[model samples]
Target: MRNERKFYIDGQWVDPLKPNDLEVINPATEKPIGVIAMGTAADIDRAVAAAKRAFATYSQTSVEERLALLEKLLEIYKRRYEEMARTITAELGAPITMSTEQQADVGVGHLQGFIDALKRLKTREVLPNGDVVRREPIGVCGLITPWNWPINQIVLKVVPALATGSTCVLKPSEFTPLNAILYAEMVHEAGFPAGTFNLVNGDGLECGAALSRHRYVDMMSFTGSTRAGIAVSKDAAETVKRVTLELGGKSPNVVFADSDLEEGVADGVAQCFNNSGQSCDAPTRMLVERSAYDKALEIAERAGRQAEVGNPEEEGTHIGPLVSHIQFGRVQALIEAGVAEGARLLVGGPGKPEGFETGYFAKPTIFADVNNDMRIAREEVFGPVLSIIPFDTEEQAIAIANDTAYGLAAYVQTGDPDRADRVASRLRAGMVHINGAPHRYGSPFGGYKQSGNGREGGIFGLEDFLEIKTVHHPARM
Candidate 1:
């Protein structure tokens, strides 16, 4: 079996402080494909020390110097672009095309965005009366990323940290370690200063806790569930380190009666099923006008049925198995919960997609006549499950969409520009997609409420890792 028993720390792959073996399962095959060594708190100490050491010199790096390294990374990433795509598909069960085109491509996109920002942004700003203001790297960072959209999450945090001259101790989700390991090799290959970037693999509590509580780690940037984000904040409070989080989203897609029914429903279904509805910003809750609710259900059912779920490596596979049995069961339990709460399951339910059923594949599910109060509508299923909630008016639709504790994303669909504009402006979300527009590559992305804090992407992403210092120059009286 392929084994990754060593952690990348201090610019080299080294054996773990203690051996704790964990088998990495191939979700599509339901078998052990590889093994990784789970790390202990001691491993985190060494990684943190290395990062702290690197930050002393790295933080003083010229913007031009950092840009040069990133430029090299962009080149190396392109050379191994296909390899990264295949690695994601093998470990995460993303369809090969999705992995290649979007999943892996997102990393390349973020790196390029950071590169452009680095060249354009001014690190130091001169003020009137000889005063000056500057943005500097916070310090060593603890980057904890999720399994869903692994590389995308990694690049958003790591690239910005490096760009701003902050070092990092990354603890990627245990579910997807190989890709992170490969990415570490890329960082190493790009010749980043030893300890500027490091990777430690382990379960959330062990390594995650260690990194979260580390005194040397000056900031914590996390992307995960809302519950976990709260925990990270509390842990970081001890050191009062900076924390930037992009957490859970039960985002709403509002479809007015004026829009093309077929097009809007199909787009919403495609998004909910994209990455098997594993995205934090997936528009799983579709709020439709009551007048067109029935037609929307029929359209949603048709769209869900059209999704071809199968082997991830095969062509035309729109959906694949959930990341692991634990995730599969979580999605299944939520689907069953929807049924129990009186929401009509128009398409799929708690079982695997009809085929040879050894893997963790989940049926693309759509629920109709859902109420905003229903458990299924409130909780994040994190699977290919869509809940359609009907509303009477635009105000009510906006209200229903904002009713959730999350405010990560909201969508608006309308043929009329005025209504789309009005409704979208009222939606309480960090990001809004009007007319089913896709997420822009370098735009600021994050949430408003319980969804978590701080923006990631472009200059906003880099700003999160930086601390502002205004050189007084004696505030002119």
Candidate 2:
């Protein structure tokens, strides 16, 4: 059965004020998969009004009640997990297996983490000076999510807003709106209040700008490129709304001579190419000690070669095409620029991988003898293109790593745990992965400098949606 195209506003699937429709394309097939209603300023107004109205009561709800609501949402999300995976596969061209495991599963993990965090949170506390400090909902929040890891980004913002008793108007990426629409359906099934949560699907100029400029919105949490994050900050400034941005990154993976060469190189390559290299925090820059540079390059090239590129629906296809034709063009341009600048292309260059000519796919690329000044090493290409830069000394490597404008994420691999920790401490990044450690759900995740401000995940995420109020009492005589 074909689904009706509508926005979720005021607890109902409502038509937009304007009928701007966008065609969702499967990057794997280069075909139109579905059509979605694109929102405008009017649509944002409607969603914001609904959220503002719902905040009056929802903000006052007890922690236990809110927890129960989140639990209900979790249950509904589980029932539709497969559907969510399929929707992402169709819309974003993420391999179905990868979507199910990494893409959709992370959303579930985030919601569950929120549920657990809320249970232990202390909303009200007594201070030393006979004062009461209360952490209250920050009112109607504006949530702007990115296309990469669509569901995970949405749930990270939404789950915490709900956990903190904040109402929200969400502007999900128009490119990948199917998973969001399905998510809205799941939220509706969870039976949230009429004005508690509203989903508005649209582009950055229309819906996103409206959310940022809306007076009723007390906070805006945005995740996307650093350029767009700057614009969102400027828009939110007019109303002095609290803004939390998780922006772009060109993260570095540093390998020491003492590290496990095979494991370090393999993990770094996998992390870079995961999600077909769409992640903002992918270890796109690899800095290895001069002594182990050749070994690391060999291992990384093998890992890149092993990546299977094909239709996202097919099993064992490790890498998929870029999200859209524009992205494909951008990646190809970057690859060409790298070659023109005289960097050695070790394996895989411009154009689609062998036997896959229909979609927007690129060969798994690796560039060696890359200087830190090269565009490929400096900018965020956001494809399966890996850069290998060798360092003669540890100090030089750390210096090279911190040379970029982005400070989102960094990875350090070394047999000596103390040395690894010391090196990680000096890197100018928000999150550091030591010895290929897995991401912890409840830990704070964010960036520094141009990368972004504030944190997401764990109590830090909930706090972003809250405002603290302190009441002082007279001391006993």
Candidate 3:
């Protein structure tokens, strides 16, 4: 019965100019949990105007002042930590352990990472010829984030924009707007100048499109599907503003025969099944060498069985329902396509995980003997779906991994250090993981190719919100 019908504008929770009632459903129980007032173009116009006004003063703030503001935000975020965890679990259906640990924790991690990175940044530097180069905040940023990792995406965009002294107006996914609302509360409490941060809640067609196409929006940071990213880019092109997109991936996890069989295969499976396989960088495709393909299949099946799909609030539950019925149907269709196209279904299939009936639950499915051309292998089926393809040699493995339209991420598992380096260098992706290595904290993250443009995370994320200005004057003594 929670009803949040206001948009945060000019540092206040104000009602939308005109509201459309939209329901937010809990995926785990297939129940309507809350309602929100979806914003219209008028709301976007108001928020963008507020942000543009604030940018005049906020963008000129000293780095030290911006750093102070970040410290306050981090402090306030920690105090409201449990609320963050609960909001994500309620809206996202992330298992309690994961919601509290990984999903919620990533927001804090990015906040802290930006604070640390900002401390080391040199805002101004002198060239050998005594010309001064300055990094300046790109005015108002319109941030459109997805539902899968709400807080992570929100913080990645907002913190950097704040740290670099850029005012922002955010349009979080209509499916998961609770956490974003909570975040706006935190920003207000932190006492940022009026209009430093504004939030407009609505779908891509209304609020998102309005913000992206706004002429006053100096930059756009979008995290979502490839189709939507392309749409945002097209809209932003009218203004010729800088746009950063973190889109889809059918990323490959290549496992060499010389690697540890049980560890590599099990880890690959776990990575694929993590977050119910909704992650953009999830290793959905595992390319195993011919000598270890069968063994990898056995280990992958075992790992999939080990992942218990049940209540998201339960203590040890590892998998939950897809975000909505639409997502559930999408995943189901891909599974059916794999069957018709003749990819060997190893475990689990198109139906909900056993013991559940009404929820948008999906069985953790795995397909072996898959070719790179298969629909399941080529498309980003964002579900608990894994495709295992076998390769005969190192060259073949690289060729297979690099053949996708996505270049968001890739993985490699090998015993030989030199071979690992060689394979990594040949892969066409923004981020590459070696032997299931954890994600790098401050490393630049984004894609090449059709995956999207620009980077986010650490110093790179800050730079994305900044513009370079060269001052050519008298040499400094």
Candidate 4:
């Protein structure tokens, strides 16, 4: 087993204040692949203090200098991209194909997005009233990322902080720390100043809370469950720090009758089941036009059956296991709930896939004739599960799509360009996907309402890490 039981702090890999070790298990094999040292409040303090001290100098660095460092980091990332993909597969049970294509790719994509955004950013500008407006780093950021899309969330938060000339202390999910460790190595090699970036491995209760509540921390950027996001907000409130979250979502996919029903439904199922259906913005709820509801159900059922569950070690289009046994259990329980709640289980039900008795794999599930109130429709199972709901009118479809507390992302599938534009404007979501369009790099990735505050990616991401200031001079001068 690999021994990775050290925390990266102040540009050095150091031992934890106390020896609290945690074993990282591979969900594909249900075995320990490595061990990482779990950090405590004291460790958070050390990391946060280092970040605070570094911010004094790092925040004042020129944008060109920061951009150069980021370019170096990006170069290193590209050179070792394959290692990152393999690391994610080993730790997170993501299929090697998806890990390489989507998971690890985000590190490069988002980093380049930030680089471009920084280049386009105007740090100093003059207002109409003869006041000079300047954008400055917010200082000493406390970044918390989840396990599902490890590198994706990390880059969304970390790159913007560094690009904006802010120092940060990261607390990546303990379940997937290997990739983070690799990233720390790249950051160090890129010649970032000591104390500019630090990482601690631990659960949310200790290291997370400590980072959020620390008096020296100026901002908190978190990506996780909605419940945990609330906790982070509460903790940060004590110190009045800036808190930005990219939390949970039960995003809706509206398929109109005019759409190519077969293709649309099939693509919807694939999106819902992508990453083993662990993505926060997965369109778990499919609101179909009543005229084509039955046909959509058939397409979804067929697509669900076709989704392959395979080994993360192998290179194939199949999805791997859930990140852990706990997640597996949660997914199983939700599957059971869908059945109990009276929704028709159109394709898969509860249990591990055949020939995969030892791993944390879940059957790709689809529930048709689902109402908005069903537990399967309301909750985020975070698995390969799809819930199909029927609606009669365009008004009704928009209503159902916006019913959820989460407004992260919504999808519109239609043949009519006018209807697509009309419905996209009405949907209560930060991002709208039209006719199976994918979210591209540099686009703002976030949501409204409970999906969390602030936007990430490109200029919007950089804006979140910046504080605005206006300098006034005498009009006579």
Candidate 5:
């Protein structure tokens, strides 16, 4: 069935001024699934104008009212959870299993988390100066989400903006626009005020740049590559808008000799290959102690081989196709470069897995004997590719881990608690997982350096949507 092709603006689904339509492809099948009206600068201006208008009233909403709205959104979001999962699997090429568990589930989780956080949030606090310090909404926000974790990035930015009473204009990745459309439907059904949430489906150059450069947008929360994030920042700088970016990463998974080698290697491989290794925080770079380098490489190869590569809908399919033909080409070229650079290809080479004729599926690749200087080691290869680099001492491992321009996440596996603590302290990333630690949903998630600024999740996320105001009052005497 042909889905809605209009943009969601001013609480209504409206057609764009131009009939410039973009075909939405099902990456797994390499077929045209649907089409959406590609929004232009004029459309963005209309959406932003609506948001600015809505913010006049929405920003004045009390914390209790905003919390109620978030709770209602959570309920509505849960009703369509399965549909969102299916859309992600079809549009973004995420395995069906991952779409259900991590992709779609993260959207619902973020909404619920925002609801819970808003309930406990103290918008008005008494200061020592006897004046009330109020945290208010920061007006209209511009959210540009990536294709990797479509709904996850959207809700992470959307829920918080809503909870803080900031109206938003969302520009989801043109590559994976289906889930964003579904989300707009949900938002409409949930009965949000006109212009409280807007969705404009278009490419970065047209719709995204318009939102960034728009003067009415008070803040911009973008999740994508570091290169694109830099452009968004530069565009938004014209108005000096607040910009929150969750960019690329080449995070290191340090495997110490004193740790559980088998378990560590297994978890590291899973983390790197999960979501087809499109995660901004995927531990793609593996740094093993020189003493256990050979063992780590063997285990990593075995783990890579074990990852089932097939259709995303098939049961037990651990890995799926790359999101697009371009991504597949990029990954193949990088894999070829890794081989040319002398990084030994332990398992996979530069091509689709055997028997996969259609789709953008790639074999789970592992490159051992990798030095820190290789392209695969330095760059963010957003595919199922792992690089195993050997480190002689603890100091060398730390130095290698901190060499990347992106510092989003780091993984350190060590049996010794003291050693783990020491290593974690030295890492440059925003979050460090020790001994295969799992991420807490409520904890703040973000990055350091070029990995982008500000934080998401927990209270930190709420802070990004709020503006602090100090009320000057004479001391009560």
Candidate 6:
């Protein structure tokens, strides 16, 4: 087992003041792969102090200087790209194929996106009224990321903070600290100034709360459950720090009768089951047009049942397992609720897939005849579970899609161009994918409602870490 009990603080790896070591488990093997020091409030304090001190100089860096560092970091990331993929596969139980294609790719893709965004950004702009609007770095940032898309969330928050000349302390999920540690090494090798970036490993209560509530921290960027996001917002409120969140979602995928039912439904199922359906914007709820709902159901059932499950060490397109037993239990209970609540268990049901008894692998599941109010349709089951609901009319489809508390992402499937545009406008989501269009890098990724506020990615992402100041010149001479 690897020993990674040291926290990255002040540009060096230091022992945690209180060595509450935690075993990092591999969900695929149900065994400890490594150990990490669970950070305490004091650890957070030390990191915050370092960040506070570093912000003085680091926050003054020119955009060109920051871009050079980012480019260097990207270069290092490319050199170690395969290692990142393998590490994600080993630690998060993502299949090697998926890890290499999606999970680890985000580290490079988002970095490049930020590099482009930074190049286009203007630090100062003069308004018609002769007022100079300056965008300056916010002070010390408290960044908390989730485990599902480990490097994705890290780059989304950390890169922007550093790109905009802000210093930050990161508290990645305790479940997946290894990747964050590896990323810290990359940042260090990129030659960023000491204390500009720090990492402390701990749970949400101790290390996370301390970082959120610290008076010296000027902003908090968190990506996790809505419950935890609310807690972070409340904690940051104590010090009146700016808080941005990317929280939970039960996004809807509306399949109209006009679209190719077979292709659209099958593709939707694959997208939902990708990452074992742990993605925040996964189309968990599928709303089918009633006229073609039966055909869509048949396609969805086959798609779900055909989703392959395999070991993380394998190099195929199969999904591996959940990150932990806790996540497994949550997904299982939600699946059980679907059966108990009268939703048809159309495909794979609760329990590990056959031959996967040792690990925390959940069978890819699909539920048909589900209502909008059903637990399967309402909750964000971070597993390979998809819920299908049928609707009678265009208005009803839009209503059902928009009824959810989450507005992170919504999908529209229709051959009619006008209808696609109309429904896309009506749906309440930050991002709407029409006919399986993928979300590219550099576009804003966020949601409208309880899915959380503020966007991440590209220029919008950089804005989150910056403070806008308008300097007014004296009356014209």
Top of the candidates by lDDT:
4
Instruction: Point out the higher-scoring one by TM-score: 5 or 6.
Output: 6
* Candidate 6: C-alpha lDDT: 0.94
lDDT of 5: 0.90
The CA lDDT of each predicted structure is 0.91, 0.89, 0.92, 0.94, 0.90, 0.94
Give the poorly placed runs of model 6, Cα more than 4 Å off. Answer: none
Per-residue C-alpha lDDT of model 5 across residues 61-121, encoded as one tens digit per residue: 8887877667777788898888988889888888888888889998877777777777788
Model 1, range 1-477, lDDT digits (tens) per residue? 678989999999999989899988888998887899999999999999999999889988899899889999899999999999988998899989999989899879999999888787778898766778899999999999999999999999999999999999999988888889888989999989999999999977888888888888899999999999999999889999999999999999999899999999999999999998899999999999999888988888888888878889887757889999999999999999999999988888989878849889999999998998988899999999999998998879988999999999999989999898898889999999998888887799999999999999998888899898988775554
lDDT of 3 by residue, 41-152 (tens): 8999999999999999998899899888888988999999988998898898888888888888987888888988999888999899888899999999999999999999
Residue 321, model 6: Cα distance from true site in angstroms = 0.6
The residue pairs that clash in candidate 3, if any, are none
| Every model's TM-score | 0.98, 0.98, 0.99, 0.99, 0.98, 0.99
lDDT for each residue of candidate 6 in 1-477, tens digit (9 for 90 to 100):
999999999999999998688999999999999999999999999999999999999988899999999999999999999989988888899999999999999999999999999999999999998899999999999999999999999999999999999999999998988889999999999999999999999999998999999999999999999999999999999999999999999989999999998889999999999988899999999999999988898888788778899988988878889999999999999999999999998889989899988999999999988999888888899999999999999999999999988899999999999999999999999999999999999999999889999999999999998999999899884
For model 1 the local lDDT of residue 200 reads 91
Q: Report per-prediction Cα RMSD to one decimal.
A: 1.3, 1.2, 1.0, 0.7, 1.1, 0.8
Candidate 3: count of backbone clashes, pairs at least 3 residues apart or interchain: 0
Better model by lDDT: candidate 2 vs candidate 3: 3
TM-score of 4: 0.99
Model 2 off-target regions past 4 Å?
Answer: 1-4
Error of 6 at 81 (Å): 0.5
Clashes of 6: 0
Q: How far is candidate 4 from the true structure (C-alpha RMSD, Å)?
A: 0.7
Model 3 CA lDDT for position 255: 95
Candidate 4 residues lying further than 4 Å off, grouped into runs, are none
| Candidate 6: residue 144 Cα off by (Å) | 0.3
